[model samples]
Target: MTQELVAQLFGKALSNPILDRMDDAASLDIEGRIAFTVDSHVVSPIFFPGGDIGRLSMTGTINDLAMVGARPLYITAGFIIEEGFLLEELVRIVASMRDAADEAGVQVVAGDTKVVERGAADGVFITTSGVGSIPDGVRISGSNARPGDIIIVSGTIGDHGATILSKREGMDFEVELQSDCAPLGRLVEEMLAASSGIHVLRDPTRGGVAATLNEIAVSSGVDVEIEEEKIPYRGEVRAACELLGLDPLVLANEGKLVAFVAENDAAIVLETMRASRYGADAAVIGRVAEVESSRPRVYARTLLGSRRILSMPTGEQLPRIC
Candidate 1:
């Protein structure tokens, strides 16, 4: 049924030349180069403390394109509604999506709708595709990180994952926890403007910072050394992870970004990110290094003066976490 639905919905090639391939999103070659990215949200329970699937779908795709150094322009959303879904709930989701797109200064130019059998689908699943133009002379990719490049994170980690967990299990903590879901095109633009030497940009999503760093290390063929003390995390989040037997480093974050920049430009890039709305808590957490023969992999220096491997997550720490 899922396969059939996917074929029925996206099987037809898009009319636009750039959108015909049925990729994540459509890329158009206008006067400037453009990039597109799409993401689907099936977060369990749909609504969480700080965000819902609607806003998450929008922000996820927008951040994907922004990670490539593009300025978001437009977005299209498609919602699959279940047969018994509440109309009021649907309206609220749409309203949230609208508000998120508006905050990002992107338009919802087109969309589609479909209803499935009550049990065949979840309450709601939202898919959003975003289009953005890449400024001339700006280039960013996971493979661009080189030895000596510095790694910086936009803010404290684990907020989204911890928040979702708290809501899912009905656990109460002293401090409020909210999903860090947010669009980051503006922050990316500022980083680009600050320096053209920005090497790699990625938002740690599904597998969190650990997975993201592992990907970069393998892609760039370099080792990453992170100072454990430098990686920021809220006290509540850390305590929650300890209680839940989870690693904060492997927790997902929606409004966070990981950037690899030239060592010389690291200070300016950090300053630029800190100035952005989404990056006020940004910090340099690590550096790229030559792959060591003994332990040529991602590692973190612990507060105890020992090194620990920042390995890829074994499995879904939190399923339907996005």
Candidate 2:
């Protein structure tokens, strides 16, 4: 893209003081312990029900930092566009990215664009790197769960994954299913303030809540026990998954987070989460079971009073649902 075209394309859509500078690189003065993460978005239908690739890129990056208990600060986006991609569509995606960044209170400090031959790549793919500052005394990680820690989900699961599946496969259930794509920085901050005993904070993305809890269990050397009836999932998402022969537990989520907090603080944390904007349907799904002699794992109790092992996904259930 020429200087003028680049300016015309992004000079205004993603214009921030630092981004508008249009220098070779960006300089940041982030302070304290910062959480830095990088992610790429290639969801098949670049523009899904709730958001586009641009919003997905920014929100996913910011949420990754939020998962680590950090307040997001800055992000850099790189776009790979196809040769025949529509300029109008490109502008819409950029505008989505700008809106998402503004809502999340983060800056798009730097970015790069590349055009590939026709059919060389998807219509558009975005890669974003984010940086955020971790507040003092707030230590959250996938490896921090303990026996008796309570597992709480921020909201319904499988929304994002199911929405993509619905759009990709042209399955609509009359109810418009949209991806739960939203930034959770403020939500995380609220939970942290409610209690310092939050042990684990993880986003159930590609592998869903089952994979995330299993990871926490093994990493923290504790067994996990969840109730099937307690896992919150939307009606439309469940319907879509059933139609698609997909497992809701294994579906991805973009705006959902699973938190493992100390038993004493569990109630307060869940209450705080419920009060947050993105946590209206928050539910306490399970708890860390007593550690066994073997490697830690996850187990789910069915509504019929039966228990079953919740295994880690041997492979991807649905590729590129992020």
Candidate 3:
């Protein structure tokens, strides 16, 4: 298109001081250690119940940086639009990205766009990258979960996964299911201030809570035991999973995070998380088992009073639902 059209798209909605000043390349002032992350969004249908691909890309990248205890600061986006894609839709997506970035308190500093042949790519795809500052003494990692640490999930699981599934299947469940896509950077900052005993922080994204917990268990050389009843889920998500013969524990969550906090600080962290905007429904669902080799990597104590090993799905349960 012309310069006028491009300017109208990002001129006001996403304009920022750093971005406006940086014509060719972005320059910087980053203090302390920098946490960098990138993610691509190609979720099926492009637009979903709660968010579109643009919002997903922004939140996904920001959350990745937050998982490592970072204060998100800036973001870069790369977009690929199909040949016949409407310019109006493209502008709308750009506006959505700006709104998400604003909510996360980050600036969209730069971006690139490319148009491909008709049917060459999905209607639109976006790749987002982010950078943030990690405070000194904050060293969160997947391998830091220690025995006696309680596992806490930020909020309801399976909402994003179920929403995509319902929309894909054209099933209008009695209760409307919506994607829980959001930015978690602010939540992480509050959590760290509440307690310095946080060992690990992970957002259950593609592989869901089960995969994240199991990965942490293996990485930390410990076993995990989650009480099924304690796991949070909305009624509509539960019903959607039941109808599809799916397990909510393995479903993806765009907004929620699972943290491994020392037992002494678990209560404080839970309270802090519940008080945060993105973590209002936070709950402690499990703990790291002291005995490493005695049980499976990750297992759940079912409501029926039995434990079952939570294995990774042999194949993709919900493909392209990210």
RMSD of each: 5.8, 2.8, 2.8
What lDDT does each candidate get? 0.84, 0.87, 0.88
lDDT of 3 by residue, 1-322 (tens): 5445655576566898888874776887999999998998998878888898889999999999999999999998887778778778777788889889989999998877777787899798899999999999999999999889999999999999888877775555555878999999999999999999999999999879989988898888888999999999999999878777789988889999999999999999999999988999999999998655665489899878999988765557743332
Native-referenced Cα lDDT, model 2:
0.87
Stretches > 4 Å off in candidate 1: 1-29, 169-175, 294-296, 318-322
User: TM-score of the candidate numbered 3?
Assistant: 0.94
Off by over 4 Å in 3: 1-8, 169-175, 291-296, 318-322
Better-scoring candidate (lDDT), 1 or 2: 2
What's the TM for model 1? 0.88
| TM-score per model over all chains | 0.88, 0.94, 0.94
True-vs-predicted CA distance for residue 77, candidate 1, Å = 1.3
Residue 225 miss distance in model 2 (angstroms): 0.7
> Best to worst by lDDT, what's the order?
3, 2, 1
TM-score rank, highest first? 2, 3, 1
